[model samples]
Target: MSYFFQIVVSGMVVGSIYALAALGLVLVYKSSRVANFAHGQIIAAGAFITFYLTTTVGIPIFFSFLASMVITFFLAMSVERIFLRRLIGEPIISVIMVTIGLASIIDGLIYLTPFGTENFSFPPFLPQDPLSLGGVSISWTQLVGMIITFIMIGGFSWFFKKSTVGISMRAVSDDQFGSMSVGISVPRVFGLAWATAGLSAAAAGCIIGNITGLNFDTLHAFGIVVFPVVILGGLDSILGAVVAGIIMGLIQQFASGYLDGNWGLNGTGDVMPYVILLIILLFKPHGLFGIHEIERV
Candidate 1:
């Protein structure tokens, strides 16, 4: 029972991070209808920037995090303005391919840096000991990461529900033509969505960096994993992303906890999501929270 509770706790921590990461993808998809392949690169770049700020420039970790978020915000906006803006209203396939190309370009750029290949962890700023409840244990980093994830999630939810800009973004997502007719700048909303996505990605990246160390590959992989999260949650639903993220995280934890060692099923957690994603696509293609738009043959 204690072990089960421990897995549940850790799974929630991981799932919240996934939720935050997927939120960025959801934001972009909701407003622009273009899936960003460059998102992983953006996440990796954000983490690398923090590493540079902390280790090379000697700033404190906290300030470096904020600084990285600001930088990525502009970077993502520039990406939209310069690259995606021109391609707007073009074929969706072309837009997705452009993002894929941009991802490759960013990947090449990161390969030039030393941080790309090395392993780095944050300086020990939290307690070394784990907090225990009964037989279950939790670490300070996981606790902090989960709290920040929830706060960010709540803040974004409130922003979407109440703020003027948020309302405008929703309007744009609902119908670009309708939004434009009503005096909303659809393009500007798209830019804002990307900026907010970048902000959230940076936060997710920083938390991941703190918890798992500054590994470029690991942090960037979240971009790929986010697809399943969004698919399960619903492509355009923020609430869906959160719920699906937690579910996926639990599945992963359970698979790793139970399926490993008993059989030759090593690393089942890593591959199971994609398999489940395939199954979901076959039957419930729209996913749980996704707006169903299936056309039957």
Candidate 2:
């Protein structure tokens, strides 16, 4: 029972990270309907930038974290402006391919840096001991990361529900033509969507880097992992993203804890999400919160 509870605690921590990372992907898809293949690259860039600022430039970690978010916010906006802006109104395939190309370009650029080949961990500012309760223990880093992740999630929820810019973005998502008729700049909204996604991605990357250390491959893999999360949550639903992320996290942790060594399975945790993804697609393709759209010719 204690082991089960331990897995639960661990799952919550990991789920929070998944929620944070998947939030950005959902944001992009919700507003612009663009599946950002370069999102993981952006996440990696944010993590690497934060690391550089903290380690090389000697900035404090918290400050570097904020700095990285701001930088990526603009960086993503520029990406939209320069590369994706002209591709607007083009075929969806063209946009997706462009993002894929952007990912490769970012990968090449990172490979030129030490981060691409080396591993690094954040400087520990928290107490180097795990907090324990009834045989369940969590590290300070994980606890702090969880707290911050929830705060960011709450903030985003409020922004979407209450803020003017957020409302405009949502309006565009609901109906771009109608939003434009009401005087909203659809293209600007698209840019804002990407910018906000980048900001969230930066936050996710920093949290992940702190929790798991810095490895280019590992950090970027969050991009691929996010697909399962968002797909499970619903491609365009923020609430669904949060719920599905936690569900996926719990499933992964429990699989690792109970199923990994029980049979021939060795890495069930790593593979379970995709297995679930396939099952979900075959059955509930619209996902838990996704609205089924009907089109007639």
Candidate 3:
């Protein structure tokens, strides 16, 4: 029973991070209707930047974390402005290909840096002890990371629902032409969406780096992993992302705990998400929270 609860705790921690990371994909799709293949690179870059700032620049981890998010925010905006901006009116497939190309370009660029192949871990600032509750133990790093993740989630939820810029973003997402008619800059909203996604990606990166030592490949894989999460949660629904993230996390954790231990199922945790994704695609193609558009042809 204790072990079960422990797995639940672990699942929630991982799920919260997934929710935050998935938000990046959601935001980009909501605004520009383009998927960001370069998102993983951005996540890795943010972790590396934070690591560099903390270890080399002698800044505190907390401050470095903020600095990385801010830096990535503008960097993402610049990417949108310089590359994606030109391809705005292009076909969706073309834009997606550009993103894949951008991902490769960023991959090559990161390979040039020391962080590309090397592994790094953030310096420990939190206490070494784990918090134990009813025989379930969670480390300080995990707890703090989980708290930070939820706080950002809550803040973004508020921003998305109540803020003027957020409202404008939603308006643009729904109808770019209609938003333009009302004085909203569609391009600008697209830039803002990317920037905000970058911000969340950075935060996710820092938390992940703190919890799991940073390796370029391991960190970047998060981009691929969150795809199932966002897909399961409906690409356009923020609430769906959160709920789906938690669900996926729990499923993975439970599979690892029960299936692997009892049935000799190996790698079930990693594979379960894709299985669920296939199921969702077959049965709930729009995802649990995705809006179904009925076109009148």
| lDDT (Cα, tens digit) per residue for candidate 3, span 136-231 | 999999999999988998998899999999999999989999999999989999999999999999999998888999999988898889999999
Better of 2 and 3 by TM-score: 2
Per-candidate local distance difference test: 0.89, 0.94, 0.92
- Candidate 2, residues 1-297: lDDT per residue as tens digits? 999999999999999999999999999999998999998999999999999999899999899999999999999999999999898788999989999999999999999999899999988889999999878999999999999999999999999999999999999999999999999999999999999999999999999999999999999999998899999999999999999999999999999999988878898998999999999999999888987989899
Q: Over 4 Å off in model 3, which ranges?
A: none
Q: Candidate 1: global Cα-lDDT?
A: 0.89
Note the clash tally of each candidate.
0, 0, 0
* Segments in model 2 whose C-alpha atoms lie over 4 Å from true places: none
Tens digits of per-residue lDDT for model 1, 1-297: 988998899889889888989989999998889898888888888888887898889999889999999999998998899899999899988998999999888888888887778888877778989988899998999999999999999999999999999999999988889999999998899999999999888888988888888888898888898899999888999999999999999888888888988868889889878988999999998889999775699
RMSD (Å) of each candidate, 1 decimal: 1.5, 0.8, 1.0
Query: What is the C-alpha RMSD, rounded to one decimal, of candidate 3?
Result: 1.0
Question: Candidates ranked by lDDT, best first?
Answer: 2, 3, 1
In model 3, the clashing pairs are none
Model 1 Cα shift for residue 81 (angstroms): 0.6
Best of the candidates, TM-score? 2
Which candidate leads in lDDT?
A: 2
- Better candidate by TM-score, 1 or 3: 3
